[model samples]
Target: MIKTFKSSLFLCAMSALFLCSACHKEQSPIPEVLGEYLKYHAEKGKTADGYDAYFDLSDGMLAAYSNDTTKAEIKSIINKITGNKNCRNIYSLKEGTVSKLDKSQTELYNYILNPSSYATVAPIEETLKRITSQGTSAFLVTDFEEYSNGVIQQQNYAKAYFVDWLKKGGDITFFITNYLENGKQKHLYFTVFDMGEHSLLKDIENALEGSKSKYTRFNLTANVVDIEYGYSGTKGGCYHDESGEDIVSVTNESGEGDCFTLYKDYHAEYYPFNETWANIVKNAKDLSEEGNTPKFMHLITGPKVNLTSLSGYNVKELDLKVTNIQDDFIRFAGYYEYTKDKTINVDENGKLLDEYNYPNKNNATNMPEIEDMLKYAGCVQDGVATLNVDFDKDFNGTSSKVKPLDLLRVDIVIDECEPKYDLITKLFSWEGNNSLEQAVRNTLQEVNPEGQVIYTFFMRDGGE
Candidate 1:
């Protein structure tokens, strides 16, 4: 009877050990993934099949370009356009009509110089609509001075269309030339619309090198900024992975491998290592004639910590607070919860599934709202912005310590960047302006209210 009881006890112990091993296999730790959707790749410029050139035959435009030098500049622009190894079309733009003209330079010049022969005024909005409808890149030469029934143009009718074009990811390059029209200095604009990845604008820019013209180019392309971990080699006991530009592994000097420990008293500050402030100053100086400093606003969102691995630790809630050391920079923080029902789907190799990708959650609904936690004044000095992240914030007034072996997959995004350059103000004249100023201002304000994401960073925190 005693021998039988001993064998039964040993079998029971073996069964318990097997069950424990199976549970451990099922609860594998989550892997750290960063920068899944932060980088922006710009479409490369290519040569188009053909291009269109439109000349406004209005009296103002004809008179502005009638000078020998200005006329030569116009012909130079046309020659550059036709110089390409593709068919080019020239058209006379007037009063909601685009009539094809002879490709001959003499005929084109004759048609452009004789304003009285074609005395109809072209509606700017109609011309823009025509260009947009064609869905092809084109050049528009005009004085941009509008007349309605021989009255001064009052309202900006083309503002809405320009805004629409900009919002649709189109780019515009304005080549402004100054000339004396009727003994007064006037401006003639050569506007190029780039609807796709075409090298037309660059070609024109190259062709007009050393020419007396000022140009301004604007596009809806994403502006990405570089970021680094820590300030002045002070990583606060953390190390950055050289393979990833945005990855930060939180480990001490003695720690080895991917995971490391963060004690309760862990604290650190990171600075934007790039020449952001210097560039701001340079951009303002280069673009501004009035020496006015440009203004930029930053919108910080989401350091979404994937707390899937912390489930075994009973981590009901975790609070990660980011404080801005400067008042000029916005102050915001986030609180995260470990949802037991939410299981991240991963493949056999531990890579996240397509639906569960990181840094791609750009939808505002998926982002956590900013709650009142802590505020620290950040500072900008020596052309660098310093920001601090405190991990020791108390949770539920009970625990302020991050549990050992806990893994935090932190993903932070920076978006809605507004870098208002003074060049915009210098682009158009407001005094007795012929709707250009109003149109430009309205379009800029409407289309770019909240700029796109400029940077996204990923960080991981683990306990020993």
Candidate 2:
């Protein structure tokens, strides 16, 4: 998730390969080995995007050919990207030891592992060619809050699995989220890092952890689409009572009363709805379809941060002992009131407008653009977006009823970062000039005292 790529691959290579290689036949100059690598990958034709093929000559010597005199100054930088405290883990893989690597991985690993023996070995250029050409990606969904002080540093497959993916020209994108059920914070993390770059983050692993939180509706009722009408369902006319008595169901010409008045001249068949209800639905659907830009009443109580644009509710007071069944998800029974008012039109229906703008489906919108909202919360990666907004709406005969827990579940879709090609494997077996190689290493470390400097060797095959 960090923006700046760290050059820690050599460190991992040293640990995994120092003993296995003809690499340790004697002390090879740091610059020579590395410079040779850049030249070699270029000769074989590889791309490096904007990332130039270079090495921190000093860092390589300290880690691979010398002692550990420096530490990576990147803890604070890592936290900036991951939203976690310390840099949890930066997993890498080395030659001959990548787990579950396919045939292509095996060939590439072998070639890099024994450069001395590579003359007899055929090139795995086709595998690398296919990978870089087609391109691949990863979607790493994480619940970073679950980490203790934001640390997930026990580097195993859980952390390092993406390395092989990157090697195969797959880029990675991370989606970090905190889990919640029944409005209670789970204080847990459920993540899935897909090399195949699947959008869904595997499963929502349920576990009993710290404390639980439930969504409490503070009687915050929204008047979603208020409609003033004469009479909708069964506009009364002449009707017989259960006792076989003739009865009339209104006192005035307007369809407004429920009392049975004396019946003399009443003759109108029952109709179920009025123009008011039809117009209300039509207006609501239109409002939502055209990008819910208008404000509506949104009622929420307490210390939860809504990382979405569907905010700004008309605050109200309420008290209701809601669904008490213990569960790990927020239950919804969408049913908001449609109060009959003295006036008969869809005018300034305030807070109710707000709720329906984001939650109402089966009307104007079937999906909510929550990904746009996620950019503020750091679910940021260009081209990477989320899909499938899971929400439910209640309706009574074409009239939508908004209720508790009308929410858009937090999930993301990321277009994976394409792996950058590097021309590091172009190094071919050539008799080394010992004095020249030694002079290169001495100059490599002697450049600048402040830190290791990048000593780029112009790739032999014009790789970049």
Candidate 3:
């Protein structure tokens, strides 16, 4: 009996040990796939509402430029807008007032053909001011030539109004159509103001397809950077399956809020997080006299990393490790920087527990000396534009290794993203010497000094 009792106790001890081991295994952290995280955050632009149509019946537009092609284009525009059920109102901008005109084709055609039947023309600024006041997406047809007193003042006012509109998330597209007027080249402007959430500009662009018009779309809204993972020739444990497309999950390390587990024995030949410029405006016609197409650089400034849940990190020592440095990484390495010292409290699940003052400035006080460590790589070469992460050397020229189960939280903050000034100048300027055209160009340069953040996404290291 004593032997049997001893044996039973030993068996119970072994059973308890097995159960505890099973529980420990169950509690182990599992990594999350990086591709799944990106797929989850990928969003599409929202569709906008209808549009309002406006036509300028000014004397300059009626008297100076009346030709068969011009009239056909005007008629096509009017007919297209009126035919669409989404077109809400048609207004004739003349006589210093915005008069509501019938949406019928006959009425609009008659008004266009017989300028004498209409009242005297008003300043073009009046029509622009009315569009600004209504705060809706609109389509306007005009000559863009202001022939009135205080042209500078009118241009300034128009610039101020449009700048405010752009600041509040608005976009503009200028369609310049050229026609022959008695052997002299003449131009007419068809402008689209995309205010609020109305995106009728694309529809109008589609309507004018195959027509002889030059397009310059000014999207003043913040540019959303596109993050693509597992780019071409990517390898290692980042992927989840044999297909090599889906990424593995990033798991938190030991329930620590900040520390994470990426993967074991992971070495990427190419950096996984590749960023590309979004919402690039493609001009329809090359207006350069030298036949040189304007090259654009999407300058990304003030990039920093932050915790997904917390406002900032509070750790004393932070290290960045980069291996396999490439030559292209040295070009744009100045843009990446580390965050300054800040106190943050997060829960075990990586949720913010206390309120912290988030840094708002562009200058980072504590920066890592990782010159040529990582860069915003890729540019237009041979008519192809590519942007990605290409890092070839070690951080600070010192070899720092990423151990197994180390998780990194990369938050790419794009403070300012815009094209170089040369592109902006080419897009806004025209062939004629018009003061309003120059003013519009100046306003574009001033307002677009620093582009806004059109997109925001987070990246993590590790996968299950």
Candidate 4:
């Protein structure tokens, strides 16, 4: 999730030792380019949701802030602290690795500081090479801009390179330092911070060991925090134009709401709840314009059984571990389209009371788990590009014959609403004996009278 906010980034002076040296006449006069670097993130990490801001660099790009005077002051401080006399453009490092770089290190930087290239691609040659051989640590990677002949282009490989880098040997929390790359970017030095951890595999293990319930539904929910999406990271954001994939687009360019939508299934008519923690949803997955059709929305490794209402019924959290099965993976995806008239709010998990007093997620907020009810409908691509989970631990279903079913909940916390979406739950009462399609039509009239958004789930391939 790459953010592009406009404000001065407050620099808290830190005491980290950087390896800098004096430059010769051939080197660019710029003392040192200060900026943040992104580390390799794997798809097989732990899984947990709730506002977990990568306080560690906010990890993804967000916000649009810029302050030159303040930034200059920070750079001055860095020069005094590090005593680094050499300054060079980000491209200089690409000429070749600095002699002082540690073994297997690739000195790269990104145009992350660039608002225009924020959504576009970037160069990763030097960095990608490192991952292929002995592991490498990059100073900068996806933030550079390249112009060929008269065309403006970016080399989009940081993500793939990072995945490969993690496999070889990567550190979630590593070291970084920024420099005065140019007039636009000031001295942005790197400091260490916490990169929240998640182990989807571990979550599953714990769930299975806890308890069991005959009510076989895996009620899952993705509390979306923030939406920093778009292929255009220029001054004003733009749409994604690059092509080469499989996600089929439903609508072309509409006026206000989502101009494009890719539904996961005819069932889950709803969404892409990327990643979380800070109540902020930052996507770390690779997003392409082509992969639009929802073909992979199943929690393949989950229990096998019949399910009841997700939030309507009482059940154990452990049953929702659709993520526990080895080789199989869990994916939470959906489409969403927000227009000026149709507004929605994503409320996080809070504390509340059920029929009986207890600490339940429902207690925290009104967002209920989607169970045997209407699925979903939205407009947009799937969630983030890099969320993947594969469990290797050994475990048998709660019962050899009776497999538990997994059903996730996606709470749509609607705030100050438009007339049509008033008191959405009213539709839940209309689930009469009519076919789901008919029920949906009537429900849509009550909730989304104008068809703002809908909810449906994607059944995993061959999944009952």
User: Could you tell me every candidate's TM-score relative to the true structure?
Assistant: 0.49, 0.17, 0.52, 0.21
Candidate 4 lDDT (Cα, 0 to 1) = 0.22
Query: Which of candidates 1 and 2 is the stronger one according to TM-score?
Result: 1
Q: Give residue 47's error in model 4 in angstroms.
A: 15
Per residue, candidate 1 scores C-alpha lDDT tens digits across 1-464 of 00000001112212221212322222111111111011112322222445678888765666676677677777677667664654367777776467887657566666676656465776666777877766567788886666678765768776766766656656666777666666766667788777654466667776677665554444322221223333222233222334322222222332232222221111211222122222323332333344422221111111222222111111122223332211111000000001111222334554443333322344122223223322212332332333333222222211132222211223232222343335444555434664776676666666553323222222222322
Candidate with more favorable, higher lDDT: 2 or 3? 3
Of candidates 4 and 2, the better by TM-score:
4
- Worst window of 10 by summed lDDT in candidate 4: 30-39
Candidate 2: C-alpha RMSD after superposition: 31.8
Off by over 4 Å in 2: 1-284, 288-327, 330-410, 415-418, 421-464
Clash counts per candidate, in order, are 6, 22, 23, 85
lDDT (Cα, tens digit) per residue for candidate 3, span 374-435 = 45443323222233333333333122322212222222223233334454344444444444
Error of 1 at 117 (Å): 6.6
Return the clash pairs for model 1, or none.
Answer: 261-464, 324-378, 325-377, 325-378, 326-377, 326-378
Tens-digit per-residue lDDT, 76-171, candidate 2? 112222322221222212221112222232342332233232221111122223223433221111211111233322222221222333334233
- The order by descending lDDT is 1, 3, 4, 2
**CA lDDT, every model vs. true structure:** 0.43, 0.21, 0.41, 0.22
lDDT of 4 by residue, 1-464 (tens): 21111111111111111111221111111001000001112212312221111111111122211334323322332222222222111221222231222211111112223344333222234434532353222223222222244333333323344334333333222111122233332122121111123232122223323222111221111111132232221111111223422121111223222122222221112111211111110111122224733323322111111112121112121111121111011101000111111111111232111221212224322323323222212212222111112211232112222122222233222221222222222221122212212322232333321211122122111112
What would you estimate as the lDDT of candidate 2?
Answer: 0.21
